[model samples]
Target: MHLPSRRPLLTGTAVTALLLSLSACGGGAAADAKTGEYKLVQNGVITAATQSEQPPFAITDSAGRPTGFAVELMNEAAERLDLKVQYKTTTLQGILAGLSAGQYDIGVAGVGATAERKKSVAFTTPFYWGFTDVLTLKDGKQDALPDFDGKRVGAVSGSVQEDFVHREMGGANLVKFKDQTALITQLLSGGVEAAVLGGASADAYVAKEPVRIAVKLASLQGSAFPMRKNGDPRLLKDIDHQIDEMIDDGTYIRLYKKYFHDPIASDLIKERPKLAEQVMNHPDLAPSRR
Candidate 1:
């Protein structure tokens, strides 16, 4: 999951000032008086923020439009709601901060639904779940988590991988990059001995780069859409409902197959038993036998 950066606690006034500064480029939406639903930033538009380079989840296509699993899911959800989306690309930090400041209606760049994040923003039902991977040069000797201790490791700034490095590899020299692209680049360039990434993202990079996954960690908390807390409960409910509908109707699985060839993560199915039934009833969707 793309986790938020560790930041110093802000004073009440400082937080308000920061939100004001961060929101200068956009206007906040007001709630609909009659329905108590959150109004769109624009009359019929959902202002969304996503990462430009978190591939397989969020990426800019050749034509420069936001198009990836997460983005497409949100786009479909918006369409079902009869709304259009205007996307802005930014770092994961920007996505979270923007949501908090009311600068964006939704954030969809593979964000993890972590407890710490729930304090300031709301998350829809998680749509995806997977593991974390440690990536190293094809010839690098590091083959396990402990092997990387005291070595230089890279992770996207404000990402869960960053948190992992801090918590698990306490003695490692942690190098933080602005995004996955930079982290992978630094790994390949020998700027860092290894890099940590989301499982699917690591697979995407390993397919095209000269890196290999040396370690695959346990499943991470699921990825979900983040919205400003206390902004609009109705909107949150609507999105969660749409996600459930998609999962039930197989729209979610169809999109999942489009980007990922691996079997559905077992933990995901465990959390959503209905999805497990779907896989069981359809052999084609079943996980490969080990």
Candidate 2:
């Protein structure tokens, strides 16, 4: 669909910030992820910025190599666009700092595209969704969380779940953790009745525990490469078109299935992040469906 043009929201200073960022961080790194060249970068090149400690979004491989669902998908997208994907990994908190300083093109971590963030950068259509669920004590099955009006809850910092808490579950006790592990650990240790985190990872952690799905709250819509404001529609169009094609051709599903494990495969995912009223959902174009 159609996203806001941003001519109205962006002030003159913000536009200057965008241009300055692009000119400084625009070029440097290129390599192939599938090939050895993917590991090495030429001296004269630009690199992208990404999250360092975040899981699912990105995490180092068992061999200590950089590899995560988002990272790999980014490499693939770069390959499809015939461009080099270079990245500097940092923390989620500092991602926006790096973006504003022109140290990187876009932040590749799991960032929720809230209206507040759009003032500084632009995001592409969402490719995946972060499944954050409600959790409770092992025996604390009350069906739904709204049932526990006065119970305490927990979530990670800079997470979509936190946003949900501040907006919807304001009456419930809410706490924030630094990461998913800590959030679940706090829940298990009785720090809170339940924790909010990505469903895939949360499911993996809560296995065999008495904790069950309280309710799958809103998802942090997964997004592809983010761009500097008004940076380059040419680049955006190319990436968007490739993603549209990937969704249609089954490549997107293959990569997602290869990295992510879930029961709600294929059809459960429909809603996506929005820039105003425009639904930035992935284009459904599987080859078989075609």
User: Which candidate wins on lDDT?
Assistant: 1
In candidate 1, clashing pairs total: 0
lDDT of 2: 0.57
TM-score for all models, in order of appearance: 0.84, 0.66
TM value for model 1: 0.84
Q: Write the per-residue lDDT of candidate 2 for residues 67-140, one digit (tens) a residue.
A: 77777777776777567767776655566666666566556656766666668777776666545667776677
Candidate 1 local lDDT, 197-224, one digit each (tens)? 8888988998999988888776458888
Off by over 4 Å in 2: 1-46, 52-55, 207-211, 218-224, 261-290
lDDT of each: 0.77, 0.57
After TM-score superposition, the amount by which residue 67's alpha carbon in candidate 2 deviates from its true location, in angstroms, is: 2.3
Q: What is the lDDT of residue 90 in candidate 1?
A: 95
